[model samples]
Target: MSQPIALSSEVPATCRACNVRHAGMCAVLTAAELATMARSARRTQHAPGEPLVVEDSKLTSYANVTDGVVKLSRVLRNGRQQVVGLQFAPDLLGRLFGRENLVNVEAASEVDLCRIPKDVLEQLVATNPVLKQRLLDQSLQDLDEARDWMVTLGRKDARQRVASLLLLVARRCGAPGIDDPDRVVFDLPLTRSDMADFLGLTIETVSRQISRLRHEGVVQVANHRHVVIPSLPRLETLAG
Candidate 1:
């Protein structure tokens, strides 16, 4: 059960200024539709490790991430757990029209969410064909990404897997206006252990592969969580 914290009373202006507004769920909405959504929407913040939606629980709300990352995962009956996916800013959270959550969603870093009531979202989706199509498109994209990750885990070697993860994170989180495509800098949203979970490797193995990449000049580690890629093409070569 997640609760919304009201950050502002004016939602339309806030939505207009949002960095992801044009690209996120709000993009398909008209001004009037957006205004209607604003009435039931509020902003909420979650700290790292806070659970946004728990597995098997009833969902009460829907959200769009305005900032930070979220990790989607599931646990087995025997207590084994794996990181299934990572959701970046502008990604939608919560299953629309679903009765319960199948995976646990947690903040990988400090996160801000535009929280909308479940009933309001359902109503909007019911009446808006464009909104429905956008949601369908998002679902298909997610399916494709999941399949690609499955291939990475099933066939790619440890080094390739690590490199692929780096490229994925950089594309998702890197700052804009770097004149060169060869260089990229971004922070690792997940810890080493969490990386292991996501990559289907052990903590020790993840650390070793990261060290190997550093020594081979594939990447420069500014710190434990910060990574710099000197050549994007070089990294992609290693990923394959």
Candidate 2:
């Protein structure tokens, strides 16, 4: 394939100041490439529960989540939505090379994103083999997580499942979850009802397990959403 037209412009200040630019999809880009991308890039923020992409909708833009949680789900024929995946900062938010969205994506918390036009991303992916490879790498990582979750949902008991869910958030946690190496803290992205839906457990069961964890000193909760894990080791033990 022929090389892309060389650019000589400086990257935008917004791109330079971005928190996730160094770790996100644009990380693999050349300085000129970044300048090209920034020419059309726009920063966007979303409130909790705001929809980013809807199932079966035509694709127009892609985003790199800067800070916050995104929930990806799909609607069944019965119009019920199934929670399929969650995305965090630095994760690319849209599927590449797709015409229409396959899932409904929403903000699980207040979100910040860098939106890149669809054509811009597609052009980059075409001429940049590294970008394509990185997309594949991310997809494989997602597939691995899904397989692991299958085991969690199928084999793990209610308590273990709850612990596993907590661990999942804690592992990818930012801000509060970033400071302590041994401790993990973050707001619960999913509510009890949402948690029940994701975990394939009843609301009462999830509530009971969380209360049990609190009683056992495995975790601390406040405002019904805030979670503080004093010991990662202890939480991992419970997840098993």
Candidate 3:
């Protein structure tokens, strides 16, 4: 007798192929639930610097980052913007069950997203305990990262701060693991200006630090945006 097909196999073709579906919050979803979600989830793309959410906007939908990076920023009272966070693929893109968005979300790189209606997602969350836990887990994980970054900003020197950011992007944005390869090459997700904003450095400072890293042979750049980490461990030591 033939074995029964796996439930994951029954997930819609589009969803079955999605990396996000296999990890993050979506991992809790059963095949039928994924099908229902996929029926309403719209795939969308954005170029670098495109805005995805405005601060204080009505929350009518939620998104899953299927590819590329997102920037989370907020406007200060003085009219300057501060980048508070970055989100990567397979991550949920906004606050859960919130009535209004608290921060602005923008594409940090060419991005692909799967958008689900707010009502639909909320309803699913209400019914699925596992899904709710998954969402909460991700939220808590983000909070932990934020706290760690506070230390990076407050205690670390400029070079360390920059290395921390590079290590962060490489780890989150699909670079090879240390166990798999000593080297990692990826498109740098944030521009120098954006990195300066995120890291609390001036653009020139950010440039100098990157150049310093290149000089040290810790990292290499090509065509401006591609970052090649010849040794992730060496970079991680600097991040500390």
Candidate 4:
């Protein structure tokens, strides 16, 4: 895929892709520092279901999601897979302090990611106190997300699990007052199998639960990919 537009000192502006949006890092970055960091970045694209990194692969660079989503998962000895987390637009990947990879990462949709060389990114963060703090803060948030997923897997049923997942995706990408119009419209980026894997359900069960929701007029399938939730509170109860 084509690399993202180049950043030049002549322009003296940071490439927007380099800023960590989810953690709110951009506002604190001085103009010059943002530009400096931008020059060291490149962007690339991946098609749906493409593996960005595999378990135990050598760590070369870090990525910031520009568009689309990615899922992180691990395979068990018996060949079952468990999805540990999902990263949406503006999220970072490959932030390990001293490892290649512990899980596999794959694109859940057509994706664009801004890539930063590992050593250069480290240098940039170490030299910039604000960026360093921001990275630390992001790490903490990620830890919390992981913990929440454990609860979803251990405590929630198929319906509740699906509900939780939907709420999460909506909150991440949904607009303000998502329920104001009595419909929450968003894309269901993951396939049924992917959803099943992530939620610890069988594909048949996932399909059944989704069908049940649609049959009950709880959600409307706008297309093969888009979903419209007619009642946010009802969905919340289903998820809980």
Candidate 5:
């Protein structure tokens, strides 16, 4: 507790899991079981724009974010890309099931993560019913998010998409609901380009849409970070 944690360029062969921030995922571990997990985790860092995993890369480990943001994107053969997901603080990274990578992972900002060997996690899950149940619950939540994103990508227009994304960020940051009947200011954590990708719009289009919102008195965009929703219900309807 006396020293600051350092990020590593690569996962050290011998690392301790006691350093992880979100060890509650392993809360059911017995003292001995916890010690085993601690021995298998390594701290790693990725600088902004660095690739953590590319399409089709072999999956060898799972990770939990300690700091910054990471993006999960898919690149098409024609060089187009879509950001499918973004990981913020305490979010998990990497796919399980030993499949080759289905998306590319990159640090959207300078990032820190706790890298856990897949084998260790699997062993823990096999012997520990509580850990297994926790993983399943987390997986179910992720599946729900995937379904929502599918709707965003397949059905929602740009305006709706942006609205939905903003709603999501607001909720993640502690907004009760899209329509809480209360006016409040929430800050946007993503860049223009990141917002565009998440909403499937060009940067210019995103800029224009935001301007339109401001002009319409629907929202107030100040200093490129804060969003003041004048009418939460109206914003929710427009976001659809």
Candidate 6:
């Protein structure tokens, strides 16, 4: 069973200033509802590699990411593992009605979370129609992303897959406030090995493709994690 972490001193009051308020589960909630949620929610932090939800375990809570990233993956009977998805800030975690967790959810980076007990979340969803609809919409969006990734895995070559993954991450990160959308800067949350797992490629292939993109001037690597894209249009063409 997962243990509850103590609430951070900054919670509740800080909830009001959260960037995801309008886009997250709190969107449909009124001030009173938000207050109620704030009271029930506890802030928690996880360091990289900490497991938020262990595979096959009983889930007792659901959480919203307030900072950093979380990774969702599963291991086969043979012990081979694959990274299935990533959850960034503002993304919801945990299956709403599910009893047991199907995958391991881990902190991919230093992470902050606002966690509500599963029972509390369930009760709220049962009584709030708008909240339920928001959950349904998020579910549909997840489904669409999964389908799109399936196509990328099945149809794209190594280089195209790498480009596509960069594009996806850039979209998630959004363009840095520069006037040009074509010039984007973001840190890669996934390691090369993680990228290989997601793209269905070998680690060597993933690295080779990234090097090729850098060599061709499609992107500039500030370091192992940070990336700068000079031309979004060119990257999209390469992704195709």
Give the top-scoring candidate (TM-score): 3
Q: How many pairs in model 1 have backbone atoms within 3 A of each other, for residues 3 or more apart or on separate chains, i.e. clashes?
A: 0
Q: lDDT per residue, candidate 3, 1-240, as tens digits?
A: 222333865879998888777787677787777888888999999999999999999989999999999999999999998999999988887778889999999999999999999988998989888888888888998999999999999999999999999999988874775666878889998888898999999999999999999999999999879999989889999999
Candidate 5: worst 10 consecutive residues by lDDT? 1-10
Candidate 1 residues 1-240, lDDT tens each? 222322334347878677677776787777777788878899888999998888999888889999999999999888988999998988889888998888999999999999998999999899878788888888898899899999999999999999989888888887633788778888888999999999999999999999999999999897698788888889888998
- For candidate 1, which ten residues in a row score worst on lDDT? 1-10
Candidate 5 lDDT over residue span 36-128, tens digit each: 766777778888888898889887888877766688889888998888887665666766566677889898777888788888877877876
Tell me model 6's lDDT, rounded to 2 decimals: 0.84
Q: Write the per-residue lDDT of candidate 6 for residues 105-210, one digit (tens) a residue.
A: 9888788899988988898889888888888888888899899889899998999999999998887764664787688888888888889988999999999999
For each candidate, what is the lDDT? 0.86, 0.86, 0.88, 0.76, 0.72, 0.84
Name the runs in model 1 displaced over 4 angstroms. Answer: 1-11
Deviation of model 4 at 69, angstroms: 0.5
Task: Give the lDDT of residue 89 in candidate 3.
Answer: 81
Query: For candidate 5, what is the TM-score?
Result: 0.76
* Per-candidate RMSD, Å: 5.3, 3.2, 3.3, 5.4, 7.1, 5.8
Instruction: Report the candidate with higher TM-score, 3 versus 6.
Output: 3
Better of 4 and 6 by lDDT: 6
Question: Pick by lDDT: which candidate is best?
Answer: 3
Q: What local lDDT does model 3 show for residue 113?
A: 95
| TM-score of candidate 4 versus the correct structure, residues matched by position | 0.85
Better of 3 and 5 by TM-score: 3
